[model samples]
Target: MAFKPQSDSDGALSEINVTPLVDVMLVLVIILLVTAPLLTQSVHVTLPKTASTSANIDAQPLQLGIDALGVITLNKQPVINLLALEATLKAEFTKNKDVGVHLYADQAVVYKKVAEVMATVQQAGIAKMAFVTVEE
Candidate 1:
């Protein structure tokens, strides 16, 4: 008579061999979970531009405003005249690349005044231009 184990007499797999597969799947799941956020992460910021739908896309914008008194304001700082304004703008564009300037003229301001400001901005090598207007 040969000696035999009692559990093997049933001729069935009493223990499962799934630990390796489970470990590999768990490792893959952990790797995906760790890297999911990084895959879609990005930086969001607004450089500046016009509200007009007709205006072209711009990356950076400089604000130029003329009040009812015909005073020129660059980014809200008052300037004496177009020459000083041009010098200041040129210096600004030198530091920032691909510059766009937006002109906000008061409704009471003359068309010639707005044109003059645009002229200076153009001379300073600022390529893009836009006009600011109220909706009403």
Candidate 2:
């Protein structure tokens, strides 16, 4: 016998199956319906009211400057020597426990002078100190 071609009725299906798609959509709708109510549920709370008050701004930082010549100044006033600086710092620390120092050192000042000043500040029992520098 001679070879023969297949008939059109034996061709692959071209229509889409919608049963699984409808089932998945129904499941997702049911999940959303269930979760939507849960999402809206929240605990009712009663909070207490407090009196309004102004913020306290009492303390100011001390500005300490050291020039290239190794001369030290506190708050624009020159200090005699390291001993005097330590004494003054101790007094300031005693005056305000939260007092902080903003140190401004000259760009040409030596490292030794800066280190010595830092040591003196630490010896005076000051825990808060910051170096002030200009942005390049």
**TM-score leader:** 2
| Residue 1 lDDT (model 1) | 88
Q: Tens digit of lDDT per residue, candidate 1, span 1-136?
A: 8966577367766888999999999999999999998999988988798686764464458889998989999988999888999999899889875778888889899999988988999899888788878787
State the C-alpha lDDT per candidate.
0.87, 0.94
Residue-level lDDT of model 2, residues 1-136, one tens digit each, is 8855777677776899999999999999999999999999999999889998885476888899999999999999999999999999999999888889999999999999999999999999998999998888
The window of 10 residues in a row where model 1 has the poorest summed lDDT is 51-60
Highest lDDT against the true fold, candidate: 2
The per-prediction tally of clashing pairs is 0, 0
- What TM-scores do the predictions have? 0.55, 0.64
The residue pairs in collision within model 2 are none
Question: Which residue pairs of candidate 1 clash?
Answer: none
